[model samples]
Target: MAKPCGVCAGVRRAVETIERALVVYGPPVYARHEIIHDRHAVDELQARGAVFVDDLSAVPDGAVVVFGAHGVAEEAEHDCERRGHDVIDATCPLVLKLHKEARRLADRGYDVVVVGRAGDDEVDAIASRIPGRVHVVSHLADVERLEVADPARVAYLLQTTLGGLDTVDIVAALKHRFPRLATQDGDACSAVHDRERAALKLARRVDAVFVVGSGSAVTTRRLLEIVAASGVPTRLVENAGAIEHGNIDGLTAVGLAAGPSTPDKLVDAVVARLKMLRPVEIDVLDGVEEFVRFRLPSRLRHAGERSSPGLGGAPLAPGAALSHDR
Candidate 1:
């Protein structure tokens, strides 16, 4: 097993927020987006009366709503207020940090450029706040095509999820193209780098590596890319049941990793299933255990955790609702 597995600190806080909100308020606690981009997590919450909607308008007036871990555009936050929704912002703190940088750069009269996948939710949120030209670049090839009005007065921000993970080379390319490019450079948190490094290392020792996470999650896809690039046989599975597709019946050694947005219960389920397939001993690599956590809405009081009648239940609690004005 790879170290630093299971949900990251930011994701944990977001999942907990929704779970607690459902408890504090009762049936039909609304969420602005799929919290954490994991299907199992969202489905479990939904069964417990967590209603997810892409638009704030879909939620009833004054209803309790929570934002996803990836965060949302500044305009969406305003929409929640305008619609009189008791909104709970479950945005990951790391994403919130990038949003702050975006606003700051735009305020300083610089064209904000973001290096990430164009249509990603995180990138979209960052771009929506900038009032000026906001260019999205992915590869080095995209750099030359950029036609910013003011190259000398350009600042670039990175999408906080997997897109920004280990993108120093891309940042360097942007700096070279835009002579006066401003950046807080290499600002991705240490945990992000650590997790990637751990996965890569695990890939080398094992003949095959199975990453357990949602297919839609940014972290899961990035981890798959990193492991696959290491010249080791790698496959992504949503849970242990998908492990058979890795074709690992004859592998001498195997590595397991869970994406940051995945729940430990799912990982545990995977491990239990893996053990049932064959006799194996569990081992964990040495790495930093992250303890970072962000603040939740003031109304989200941690009363206690109890089973919420979801498939493979999780700790659920009840709490208060928050209006933006409060």
Candidate 2:
């Protein structure tokens, strides 16, 4: 049975910030990356005058630019500042917190180990912020190859979207090698923990599993791996259109989940498509109920407040609401 699981608070905040930016700044607003990794969200923003570019060089001088939810390298931020671009930071606050922790660990003279996929945008950003002291490791093998100044003077930071089970093994490996190693104050963001736990529980009870999210999204890929590890057949799709009927044939019951960047509409579309594929009864697999809401950047918040009809007497665009919800 399909369930209602998609779009965490951070992702929802990023999208809404971009939408409000469009409403306030008009056309040609620039985004440094695919605002969140989901194609549907990127396409929708592009259709509404959000121009996404890889490098700051692609954006015009003095234009308003938004950093993506995954965050960006320090060099990218310097470039934006050097180019005189009016920047609206849409980086998720949890990721910002991770970056701060990485810098603090490095400043404390600890050889920092970032436990995540090398070259992932978030991982790169976190590592880049710590300069010469950061090392990235995906598994125990990577940890075995790590060379540091002192085994006792080491600290580790986790990528916010990594699965909890995978993190456990990696953390254990780090601790085994460096008995004095330090870690972040808590587990990865609560959103990551909740979604992964729910997905695993749902995957265990189903004949097959379908994950709705972009292939490039790390969280979605992690979800796919975790579910598949449970011995359940699983597939990762961008949307309902990508589902192949033959692959799901003869399945009596199926489970559905989506990544943090996935929109609710995609989940609904996949659920509707599943019903058309076979006469299956749909049910919601209850999981953790998320209620976290990240505040928008100051610029967007001020603009939204002024643009509200009741506040400044200026009418907002139709369908635009000032509230932030997950």
Top candidate (lDDT)? 2
lDDT of each: 0.75, 0.77
lDDT of 2 by residue, 1-326 (tens): 33336777667667777788888888888987777777776787889899988777999889988787788889988988999998888788888888888988888889999998888888999998995578999877898899999888999998877767778888898999999999876546766667777888898788888888888887788878888888888989787887768967888888887777677767778878877887767678776655455667777776653321111122334455434321
lDDT at position 172, candidate 2: 93
Candidate 2 regions off by >4 Å? Answer: 1-4, 242-250, 275-281, 303-326
State each candidate's clash count.
4, 0
TM-score of 2: 0.85
Residue clash pairs of candidate 1: 23-317, 23-318, 24-318, 24-319
Weakest 10 consecutive residues of candidate 2 by summed lDDT? 306-315
CA deviation > 4 Å runs, candidate 1:
163-166, 190-192, 244-247, 302-326
